[model samples]
Target chain A: MAVLPNAGADALLMTPTPLADWLVVAPAVLPLLVGAFLIIVRKRLHWQAPVAITTLALVSLASIALLARVWSEGTLVMTMGRWLPPFGISFTVDLLGALFAVANSLIALGCAISASRRVIRSSRRYGYFAFLVLTAAGVNGTFTTGDIFNMYVWFEVFLISSFGLLVVGSTRAQLDGTMKYGVLNLIGTTLFLIATGLLYGIVGTLNMADIMRKLPLIEAAPLMTLATLYLLAFGMKAAAFPVHAWLPASYHTPENATSAYFGGVLTKVGVYALFRVLVMMFPVQLLELQTVVAWVAGSTMMLGALGALAQNDLRRMVGFQVILGVGVMMAGLAIGSAPGLAGGIFYALHSMVAISAAYLLVGVIERRSGSASLNALGGLWKDVPLLGAIAFVLVLSLGGLPPGSGLWPKVMLVQAALEAGRGWLTAAVLVSSLLSVIALGRFFLLTFWRPSSTESRSKHDGTPRVLGVLTVVAIVMGLYPEPFVAAAVRASDGLLDPAAYINAVFGEQG
Target chain B: MKTLIFRTVAPYLTALMLLFSVFILLRGHNEPGGGFIGGLIAASAFAIYGIAFGVPATRRAMWFHPIAIAGTGLLIAALSGLTGLFSGTPLLTGVWTKSPIIGFDISNVIIFDIGVYLVVAGAVSSIALALESTEDNH
Candidate 1:
């Protein structure tokens, strides 16, 4: 690819650096390579599980290293093909991006372990492992990339792999789910493409930092229009409010491992894109738009919680919880304050781990009981005390109960909203938490607390161990949230002030 | 049920199309022809072969499974990009080297394009084969 000359002389003068910047790209690239390797050897069914698991473990390590490097050294930027800024594709890793990337890899690792025990033999032979690794690469790429168009490409890469993963078995129900999932996501991505094209037309560059730097010079009407397009596109992707119909309709239809992976990482990619574009790229310029997002966030939280309350199926209920988490993140975005954004960021990290673990626990429960319906599952507290305990902790975390990771972020968001005089938002946050508690409590009472009706016993598997680790991680995050909160604060500081990012991307001349 | 005229012409047609696909793949770096279109052409050639003969015959002709071909292509494409890391450049940087025997310039870009071509052809043909075979079962 030819590298186009950037507008500024400073950008033009800077030459591409050496390969030392592999830290930024490796987290994404390593997974892509491993995925390709997996695809090639897919026929070797026996080795597929081990190879995929090992590769994800390595990817997890790389992501952790990337996160550590960024935390210690600030934002890391790498331009592809030795090209300068605003020309070559760049991968920028800030605290938020690195944290999410690390979380995504860990979730993939957990899901890979669970999937080895849970996914059917046929699916494994049909390139399921390949798709899983590809999804990780796409998620990591989406988090790390700095270019808007590159972000769109990463989203497509993510979408295609996830679509394949969703429909791997080609069951009638899976086909139906894939159709809904595919069509809606296609529309969302097309809108994102249009928005990217429009932004390029306006600013003549798709580099996010460049756009932020030039945002002030653009007209408000066009920027606002572009902002609305992005909100619609990413809102659909994040499963926020009106456009969230596809998520609940399709998420529960997939295998539990697939659902857990989607729950853990996919929608969050959309939410991350929303935060990156709407909050970081156009912070002050879109104040009115942010207010609108706040209202959407409130409705999303309320409606999602209500939807969860109405569900008897465990996976569907957890699916609605995912939507509820989106609203919480958006509320933080809506608050447009450092504390609000920090809360949103912290909540995002917390929910990704907790919600995914909940889904995996549901998978374990379904396996044990041979059904996912709450009515069919009973007296698990007596039979499988370990599962019951993990489920309890995950449900409490999902409900934003005290002594869970979920509560700290909610507290921060509520405090931020109240301080900002957004009483309605604060109420919305609290009321949603109450609704979540009711829904989760009902689920807990029916599934774990009630007397058993059948004498079915479940086979012992390694799946719960993966889930147990996740539960421990969540509890640790909940009890000692200082590091995560501090990371969020640092990330929010970056979001609020794009100058540091701009300077890092373009050097001192910026 | 196969027509005599189609059966007689299919082999030559497939051969011509395969040659044309390679031409397209090689010229893709500086011109309009590239991996995606080339792969489509190659897949169409096999599709015609399947229609005239049968799906089993087409699979036999291809030798390797279509998914495996696609996988190999993906591996090649990724490895071509990874080559940049060895040269002290960023990933996916197109590196050119002079062919000592041929005294001509060769580029990793063409290899990457070839990989893409194989992937598209393999993936498309695999889907077509699956659908075609399922029709018999139905």
Candidate 2:
């Protein structure tokens, strides 16, 4: 049944008891429950793969249902502990949250499928699936949560789980990378906590909806400070510009499955938080800090492309590509217009799938060639036509070319930048895409099209089906982007004008 | 570091601390003590026992992998939150009741607290035992 009627409907028709409120919490809760269960049966290898895949599939289905519900019902709200909105924790599922949650779970589902085939038995015994599910729980929780401090709690959840996932193989390089990843991420987490605390102090509330309502009422100076603190904290977490060093250093250290998952879904959480907090809650402060964001976004784009170009290892190159996607999204954020935010949201949705597909494709190529070094790898096209085809699509997608998912978002962002009269951002968007094409196109040309330099490794029977699914989705979005673009535009509307969200939380409660 | 007097006193000290930890967990809802502190105390008890009697001995006494115990605790805590569903309330809402046998008030909150206790005790003891075992290896 529908939760509520459309917006501007009569308040009297709002039911005190929402029948489907449990749906709001399911995306976060189910994975956590299954993750803990997986830990209990960590010794049993047979149960882990099937159980994790089924749980993620269920989560994806539930998130899709939530997206549908929020699409029709405007915004869905559920408060924990039976308390009112101001005192209780709220799970508000607006269009943006639902969109991201769906994308997050779908990407995770893809990674889980690849991991079941790729991750060895020993790592599975050491709670690999458990860490993956827990990280999913954290990502979904961050996407759905309506409270700022609650968002911080979710950050710590995934940070710890990602640490576990990162160190699964326990190799020396993995340890080193995990250490770099851990210390820097912990610093970012601490900054998030501190910023959250200060925001709570000044506003006396942690709910995002409430903060949005109260922000304009408070003094501007403290709000701007809080905004800067959040920008730094989330910016670092998102791996923007100067603080992006840890990503390329560590993302390649883990198993390819882990790297695919991280590349696909993890950092997007920080971007989502930035959109929710700065764009939604403190619009004025975002406007004030716009120039800083544009600079960070522009430099991150150039450096990320350059870094990708300089990489010898495929995984590290993908890591820099991940950073490049972050820059593109940040460019949209820097524009701070309706279409700009829409562009950011669209790019994030695309990156979540495209980047993971890229990582998985690289994993497959490395498995086939027994090497990830671009200089040593060649001739996948002659060796395996299917693998070459997947790589071609991925290269196009990551390069923001016409035939894949990346094109529309870049178009939206560039158009938005042009409309907003931000020539630098427009140039950044175009230049970044051009450099990305050079880097990724070079990768495709060298690894797939060129003649072989070494003998192939022991060939596996088949790749996971999810890679095809992601590639198809990217192509569909690129070719026919009407629905995705419409959803993004609606999501940006919800973000810019949060009255429906605020109402869903404050207006309807037991 | 395992002195004769310390080893001799450790058993009784561990017992007392375990009992006190339960007491603290039970009184948590109405008083200052709760699962977190109580679990810390219990874990401290295990650490002390491990120091005196050795890691394998402590593991033998527990009869379960510390991580498994932690996982079980997490499951219990998450299930306890579902208790609200039966009463037509939101997830994690405390559902109180009068215990006919015990002649006292109880709730899912207490069950959740016990889950928290097991999680804390299991996780911390695992960490403590790991450190001790690694030290012995050295």
Candidate 3:
């Protein structure tokens, strides 16, 4: 087999040289690389027992180490094989990128732990789990990669794995859901490609730093507009309301672990890309189009939340809720201030963690009650204390309650709206948050408390230990988020400073 | 019988297709061929093999879903772009070297080209695989 070029000179030479930063990049990517190898060789392996769990564990530890390194040091720049930027591919990690990359890895590890049982029951299931883990690898890697072309490449990575993950069951419903999912995402990706190619054509450089160096010098509204087209493409991938038909249909297609991991982590990659492009490479351009983004964000928030309110299925309701959060985060970005960006970033991080936990518990709900319908289930707290308690905490955090990470983000958004001097926008965000609270709250009450017609006192309280492990992690992250918060700040700082990025690439490589 | 295509031609076709896939990947950076087209061609070969023989026969010769190959390939390609962050370019800026590789332009775009080859190959192959699996189940 051909050896991966990941073993490049720059990547291999991570030291005082600019390439040292490339070390940070490996944490996000190493998993998929290893997992994909294992998956490809699964049929030949004698012992598949450790294949999923061991890889997930290792990836999780690597992600943790990556976060540790980013937090301890300001930002890490690891060029592959000591190769300079603008020439060789580098894996760079700022605080935000590393934090999420690590968090996503850990979350994925948790899901894999849970899915261990589910997979063993089905011989072909490990192949599917491998795909899911690979998607996580893609998710983490996409967030960390600073290159425009590489980002697009990672998006495709996620798409391919997720496509497989979503269609794993291949049931009639899964088939229909996946077909729709495939067509829409393929279209979105095509547009994303067009955007990348166009951006490259205009700038003649595909590196993020190079684009930043060149972007401020170029004077063309059409080029800027085309770049925004890519942002919109990414937004559609994030499942913003107008273009989000595939999410509600496809998310519920897989079993619970997937809805937990894939649903939770997938769209965040798109949102992360949007934020990276807007705040990092083209802030000036993004700010110029702020008004349009503002209105869109407000509308999206309202629409997604309302959609969530109408959903009757447990998974679909949470799926819509995640979309609603996307709307809120966009609104924060539209506000466009230090607090606004932080809030938006915080909300994004919160949603990724919260949705997965909610979905994981939904799986337990499905396992126990034999149904996930609002009409078919309830009295979870009376039956399963731990799941109920954990779900309560995670759902509340998602709902943006007091003293939680979600609340701080909303506070920042409020501050941002005021900063933009858009009094109406501020009110809209507040109103939207209120609407979300109501929608998610109703889902909670309906799913957790409202006694279904077939409400049973007996609870299958034996949630796999894996679910417990992830639930604990989510709650801990919710309680003490300083490390991640700091990481987000660093990522945002780097995002705002295109000059440093440009210098890294052009000065070293060019 | 359809098995005749399987018995004689399929084996030769399978090896030929796999070999061609590699050839396309190597030349992609210099030309229009890369991972996407290469992967697609290989997938088609597999599909042909699948039809002539059964999916099991085709799969027995191959391992992994084409999409998974693409996913990992996508990861590799994306990591290449981020390498710019260390050097201080916006993500995905290509660096060209006028250094004569015995007198020619050697660029990192080749890496990008390889990524495209894998992504296209993986995507097309997976889509085909998915459709085939769906039809077989039905």
Question: Which candidate number maximizes lDDT?
Answer: 2
Segments of candidate 2 deviating more than 4 angstroms: A1-16, A508-510
Clashes of each: 0, 0, 56
**Of candidates 3 and 1, the better by TM-score:** 1
User: Which stretches of model 3 miss by more than 4 angstroms?
Assistant: A1-22, A44-49, A80-83, A448-452, A455-461, A464-485, A506-510, B1-138
TM (B chain), model 2:
0.95
Q: lDDT tens digits, residues A260-332, model 2? A: 8898888888899889888998899899999999999999999899999888899999999999999999998
List-wise, what DockQ does each model earn?
0.49, 0.49, 0.14
Better of 1 and 2 by TM-score: 2
Place model 1 in a CAPRI quality band.
Answer: acceptable
What value does the lDDT take at residue A346 in candidate 3?
Answer: 80
Q: Which residue pairs in candidate 2 have backbone atoms (N, alpha carbon, C) closer than 3 angstroms, thus clashing?
A: none
Top model number, DockQ: 2
RMSD of each: 2.7, 3.8, 6.2
Residue A60 displacement (Å), model 1 = 0.8
Q: Candidates' TM-scores?
A: 0.95, 0.96, 0.81
Which candidate leads in TM-score? 2
